[model samples]
Structure formats: structure tokens, C-alpha cells
Target: MASSNSLLSEMQFLCPICLDVFTRPVSTPCGHNFCMSCITCYWNDTPVCQCPICKETFEKRPDLKVNTFISELASQFMSLQVTDAHIWSADQQKASCGGAVLCDICTNTKQEAVKSCLECQTSYCDVHLEPHHRATGLKRHTLVDPLASLENMICKEHTRLLMLFCKNDQVLLCDVCAISRHVNHDVISMQQAYKEMKALLGDTEAKVQQMIQERLQKVQAMNESVKQSVTETKDVIANGVQDLTTLVSEIQKSQKELVKVMEEKQKEAEEQADEFISGMKQEITELQKTMMKLRELKQTEDQLCFLQSFPNSSLLPHTMDLSTFSFNRHAEIQHIRKSLSKSVSELKMLLNKMNTEIQKFSDDTDVSNNTMLRYMQQFEVDIVLDPDTAHPLLTLSDDGKQVKYSMGSGLWGIQNLNPNMFTEHLAVLGQRGFSSCRFYFEVFVGGKTEWCLGVATASVQRRGALVRGPGCGLWAIWFLEDKFETFSSPNVPVHFGKPERIGVFVDYNGGQIYFYDRQTATLIYCFTECFFTEELYPYFNPCDNEYGSNLDPLIIVPVSRME
Candidate 1:
């Protein structure tokens, strides 16, 4: 039986073209057996008729015949063989042990791995893993699910199971390694480390998602800001265009009126010239007629007759009115042109002022405040103290530029007091007054603890109690008891440091007053939309000396222009 099985296995019954058991086997002229259909299909595809296995050629295709004896022998052998149809296929072999993890102990015929031993760094099948479950020595091996790389489960240096995690070095460690190199480091079991690391990863992912959301919100806000800016810019452009168009129309109207005035003067001059020419022509014709009459009188030889005729003749013209014809030709036009020129000069000045305002709005430099101060300096006034407007308890300097509060029984005891003097409040007014233009002045309030400085209207109370506020015709900023405040409807607190020199600017036409710290050029406070029907004077109040704390005199300083 063994000899017959060996003989059947060694038989060559596969077709070379199909590489499988022959089907309808046929013998070619070269004695090579092949599947009849396989050879016929091969011959039909190629130009030369040849045996596939032997490469033997033929002039005409052979009439192939089946090998009956070989076919019968192959059929008998196939029937006698014990064929197992349920054998493992190639794919199944690869899934089990051919391509997957194989048992290390199954050296003769490798089998699929079932479990892995972390301690031994080896894999084993069910049959070979029995020792791990039975033997006490093998039972100590840490077993887990089958893995391809078991070597990674052991420490390379210590040759021991990596059962611990070293957090300081961020590496895996063994029990022996933990006691040696990682003894001082933070170490924990691998399971605990894995759980902690997974939790941290979750937190990191959440943070990344939150950051993405925040960026998206920022993008949306930026888009909204851009849209609003574009809208506002368009509105500004439209308004500017309208304003320019209106200005051009006004200029054109003024130009036409000026030209009309000049044209009228020119027409009057031409009319005067026509009247002068007509008068001269009539005189010339009368003279010619008189000469003809004289020649006729000479023919009559009578001088007396000629003299009498000349006195009564129509040729003799009456005294002509030359004064009208001798009038200045350029007088009318000159007067009109001068008036037009003056109007144009005023318009030029207005345009220059408008240009300056536009430049102020467009300038983007840090020196804008300084530039404003310099411009305001042109309106600087030399402020002097008015003794008549000062409180009787206040003392003024000889130069009338400084004043301070006097605590004595007052000037009423020494000299006659002015009725207009501030008798209740320790305040004083400047000598000069402004009614319409802008003016700026600075006061040195250094070393003063309590003081007030600003502008006051002419009608401000001078005799009894006084109200220190804008509504009461007083616009001022005061420093009292370490607090800075501005006088308004309701006193407003000013957030500013103590300044040595205080600048006061009053624009009567603009109905505004501004206070500034001269040293830093920083705005301290402003009074806007103030109604001033009378003249305004710079007001100063050096509060009563409280134990000499407010002794420093309120000195009026000159404004220094910045280059």
C-alpha cells in the first residue's frame, strides 16, 4: 500500500499550462500530455503550432487523441487515495501559525499561540502552556494575551520582567531596576501609570478643542469689526463729497457777483466816452459852418457885418460841460475791484483755518498735544492780579502777578476796602478780561496743598457767599485735602496727579475751557458748552493757610512755547 501511494504521488499528471491535474488529457506529437482545451486555446492565440512543454513545432496542427490508459490509471489512483477535503486551507494556515504568532515550544511543527508569558518573554499553545498551570515554578510566570513582541515586556539591562513604571524618567522598569537606579525616582505599577497617562491625554484633547473654539470666536469678532469699519468709512466719504460740492457752489456764486460788479463799471465808463465823442463831433461841425459864414462876410467887404454875424451865428457853440467828460475813468472799477479783493482775502483766511482743522484731525503723531499747546501759546495773556477783585483777606504781590491768602483781621482795618472785592471767598480775579477771543495762561501752583484756579464771568458774586461752579459763572479745577475736582453742575472728581504748573485755556467763541498739566502736556479737565454772556476773567483762590500747609503763593507764569 505504501509503495502504491508513493508511486501515485510521484506521477506527473499536471498540465504545464494549467498547472493542475489534467482534464481530458491528450498526447501531442511530441508525446507530452496536456489538457486538450488548454493546448487548443494556446495554439489559437499564437501563430506557431507547438507543444507547450516540449516546444516541438508542427507544420499542421495534429489531430489530438486522449490517452485512455493513463486516464484510467489516474482515475483508479484518485479513488483509492484517502482524500481529506476539510483540511486547513493556505489562508487558514497563515491566520493560525504561518503568518501569526507561533508557539515557541512547538519547534518540530509550529502551532498557533494561545498565551504569552511576560516573565519568560515566550509564547505557548494550549498543550505547551500546561506547565505554566501545573508546575509551581512555571506558574509564577506572568501570562497574558498572545503578543507578537514579547521581548519588549522584559528589561534589557536587568533581564527581568518590566512590571513597574518610572515616572521621573518616563520609562518602564523592573522590580530590581526600581530598587537600584530608580530607587529615588517616583515609580508605580504599570497598570496605575497607564490609567494616569490616559486621563492626562483626555485632558489635553479637551484643552485643544477649547483652544480651537476660542480662535473661531475671535475670527468671527474680527469679521464683524471689519464690516462695521467699512460701513462707517463709506458714510464719511459720502458726507465729505457733499460738503465739497456745496463749497464749490458757494465759490462759484461769489465769483459771478464779483464779475458782474466789474462789468457794470466797465459799461458806465463806455457810455461816458460815447457822450464825450458826440459833443466833440457837434463842435467840429459848428466851427465849419462858422468858417463858411466868415468867408461870405469877407466877400461882402464888411468887418462890422462879420462881427455882428459871428456873435449871433448858430456856428458859435455854448460853453461845453467838460467836467463830466474829464471824470476819472478807472475810479468806479478801482473801487469795485478793491472791495472784491478784500472779500477774497477774507475767504482765503477762512479756507486756511479750515485746512488747519482738517490737518489736526488727520495727524497721527504723539506730538499733537504739544502742537496744540504751541498753537494756543499765540493767545498767551500776561495775567496780573486785580486788587479790587481780590478778597480783603488776600495779599497781592507788588508786581500784581502773585497772590496768597492772608489770615489776619484783613485789609479793612488798614485801608479802605473796595466794594467789588471778594469779601467772603478767598479768591481774586485777573486784571485783563476776555469777551470773544481765545486766551491761555499758566499758574504755578507748586508747593500748595489747597488751591483753585480757572476762569470766572464778570457777574460772579463778589460780596457775600459765592458758588464755585460753571452754572454760577465759574469754571475751575480745585485741589482740596488731597482730592482733585472740577466745578460743574455736580462737581466731578478729576483723576490726575499734582501738577506744579497748571495751564488754563479759555475759548469764548467756542464756549469751552480746558485745564492741563503744563509739565506733561496732559489734559486735567475740560468745561464744554459753557454759556458766557459777559466778559471772563482768570480766577484764583488760594485757600486760607491751615497751619501754613497752603502758604505757597499762586504765581502767574508765562507760557513757554515748544519748538
Candidate 2:
């Protein structure tokens, strides 16, 4: 059976083209066997139809088909090969031993060692190790994990195991060395020395871990600082661009107005000169007509005619003396020219002094606070709380401008049946919704240890626990656990001093939300590139009243303009 199996395992089942066991064994007309795919691929690559092994040619490419008999035999041969692979023998077992240390006592088929004896200086397999466990004499010897070489553990000079530790020299010593050269040294057992060194190493490891933690914290701090610096720098550049652009526009406008003023002055002077010239031309024409009449009378057979036509002196026009008729062309615009000259000189002085003004603008930390707040104040709206949207345990003031978390039932024991009312969270929305380009409002959070303020879309979820963020139609910041953070995915912490009043400003068209410390006019944070498709209402939450720490009401105070 073995001989027959060996003969079947020969190259008879292999494909002549692929030189391996046939996958889908096929036969050609010339009686040659090959893998079906290999023959097909080979035929497709070459123009001529021929067999790869025999080089036999065919007139037309014959349709190749898998040979079931050869294919079944190939399949049986593959199975036989797999079966033989699992039959492990002693030689295979020896090869499988890998690089482990083998028993020194076993002459044939050595087994892997489990332990090494210090006294015998030899490694032993589990079977051979049984003697040391049973024998009283060998039981006294020390056994350790197998070592490739036991020479290192023995003292070179004493030819004995180093079993003691000398503290003075900080070295391992043998039994003979302990009483010889190391006799005067501070000696102790090796186990005790190991315990002490391990304890010291643990302390060093703890210190290293603490240093790593400190450095990690410092890295986080530096990263945060870099982020803050980048944000501030971008803000500064944007503000500088806006300010400089506005300044340039104002300069251009002033220049246009100045040019108009000078042109008007010149036009007035030209009109006055034209009127004087017209009067002088009319006088000259009248004088010439009078002279022509007198000449005709002097030659005259027309003396009677001249006396009849000549003269009612009251009807003749009177001419002014040439010396007294003086027109000062420069006089008409003289005052205007003087004013323009003075203005130009002053403008030059201002241009030269612009360095200080620019420096002041750069040094002004509160410039944005004042400028932005003052502009945003123009769009300020009076925000009043909506009782319809107030949570069940929330109380609204009579003026609808303040809200607080109620300890017991709602205010006046009136249950709100409104569909828009919040059923879970201690929150309320503004009575009026804003849909304009921009809006501003302020909320006084004084004496309150916990609060939330911002704007929410009109379609915000009110019946259940509301998730906070743009995705939930809410863009807000809150103070909780004595820390300020935005209600974003992985909430971002805001580093700023607490303010009594928070000013919320929204630029709907620009998709931005800004929170300001109203007291100091400081910009606390801004949410940029937000999407506001629908009307938004002011959102407020005064936290719970269970803890006396947050009993203060959140008031919607009127915005005060800052100049």
C-alpha cells in the first residue's frame, strides 16, 4: 500500500504547463494533461494554437474540456498528500523542538529543559528534574529557570556560586570571598539585597512616571496656548483689515467733498466775471450808436432831423469812468483759496502724525470690545421669556424678562398644556423669535452659580431631554461645576473670568454667534460658520433649585450701548 501510494504521489497528477498538481485537469487531443486555466491563458497569449509541453499543432483551436477521470485522480492525489503531511514521525518531532535548551543526560531524542541546578551546574528536563525533587541530598541544591551558561553565576577565582551581596563594594560575592577579601565589607544575604534594590527601583520608576505626567500636562498647556495665539492673531488681522479699509474709505470721501467745494468756488467766480463783461459790452454798443447819429447830423442837410431824434438827455445811458471800473479776478475766490491752503497744510500735518494714531490702535486691547459692542447695540432687541415654552418646574417673572427654577410645582400651580413647553430640562425660550440679519441681547446672570445662555432654532426639541449643539438646533455656552464651556460635541472649555452679564450677539446672514462680557466689553467666545435657516429664539436655563447654589434668576436685561 505504501509503495502504491508513493507511486501515485509522483508527477503523474501534475499539470505539464504549470508543473504543479492539476487544479482543473484537462486533456488535449494529443493526450497531454494540463490545468484548464493555464492552457486557456497560454492559448490566448499566442496566435498559433499548440500545446506547451509537446509543441503539437492543431488546425483550429479545439474546445477544451475538463477531463473528469484525470481531475478525480488529481483530487485523490491531493488528498493523499494532505494525509501524509499530518503523519508526524520522530525526525519531525526532533525538528519541532526549536531552539530550547535540551536535557544533557538524554543521549537520544533529548527533551527540553525546565530547570537548572546551581550545585550540579547542569540543566534538566522535567523527567530528569524528578530526581532533584525526590532525592534528599539533591533537594538542598538551588534550582532556577534554565540558563544557557551557569559559569557567570559562579565566582571566577573561588569557583563557587556567588551567594552573598557586599554593600560597601556593591558587588556579588562567593562563600569564600565573604570570609576572605570581603570579610571587612558590609555584607548581607543576596535575597535581602535584591528586595532593597527592587524597592529603590520602584521609587525611581514612580518618580519617572510623575515626570512623564508633568510633561504631558505641560504639552497640553502649550498646545492650548498655541491654539489661543492662533485664534487671537487671526482676529487681530481681520480687525486691522476692517479698520484700515474704513479709514481709506473715509479719506476718499473727504477728498471728494474737498474737490466739490473747490469746484463750486471756481464756478461762482466765473459767473460773476461773465456778468460784468456783458454789462461793459452793452455800454460800448450804445456809445457807438450815439456817435454815428452825431456824425450824420454834422454833415447835415439833416440838422432838423438830428434835433428831432437827438436828445432827451434823460433817455441816454450814463457811462462809468474807466479808472473807477476795476474788477479783481482773484478777489472772488480769495477766501476759498486761503481756506483750502489751510486745510491742505493741516491734512499734511495729520498724515505726518499718523504713526502715533496707528500705534495707539495696535496697543488698544479694548478697541474691538468698544467698536463691536457699539455697532451691535444698534440691533439690540428686548428679550422676554415665553411662558408657553417654559419647563414644568420653571418660574417666569410677571414682566416675562426673568426665569428661575422652581423648587416645588410651577409658578401659581398653573400647569402649562402648551405643546411647546419643555417637559424635562429647566429651560425657557424668548417670546419673540428673531429672523433678521443680526440681533443682540444681554442676560444678567449675577449671583447664579450655574446658568446657560444662547440662541436656539424655533424648531428645537422641547418635550424631552434636549441635546445641545448646532446639530440639535442649539448654539450655546454654559457655566456648570464652576467652569465655562460650550455645548459642543466634546465640549470646549472657555478660559475667562466670570461676568455678571453676558451679551449674546448673532449675525444670521454671516452665520456667527458671539458672546461678550458686558461688564468689561470683552469678547468671551465666538461660534463661527453656523447655519441659521429658521427663526431663532433666545434660550436660557437657570439650572436646578435643588442645590441652593443656583437659586438666582436669569434676567433678560436691556442692552446698554458702549461707545
Q: What is the C-alpha lDDT of each candidate?
A: 0.80, 0.81
lDDT for predicted candidate 2 compared with the true structure: 0.81
- Candidate 2, after superposition: displacement of residue 179 in Å? 33
Error of 2 at 44 (Å): 52
Residue-wise C-alpha lDDT for candidate 1, range 222-269, written one tens digit per residue: 788699979988998899889988999999987897788668877887
Clashing pairs for predicted structure model 1, backbone only = none
In model 1, the worst 10-residue window by lDDT is: 407-416
Index of the highest-TM-score prediction: 2
lDDT of 2 by residue, 1-563 (tens): 24766776666877777789998888889998889999999999899999897899999998988889888888887787777666655457766654687787778898989988877888899999999999999998888787665777877886677879999999999889999988788999899999999999999999999999979977986898799989998997899789879978988998898789778877877787787788789888998887787776566666677678766775456875679766675775687678878987997787777765556456777975677788788889888788898887788878898888776555544437689898887889998888757999988999687788888999888888787545888888887655678876436678457688888999997788999988898887898757778999989989984445787789888877773
lDDT of 1 at 81: 48
lDDT of the structure predicted as candidate 1: 0.80
- Model 1, residue 322: what's the lDDT? 68
Error of 2 at 76 (Å): 54
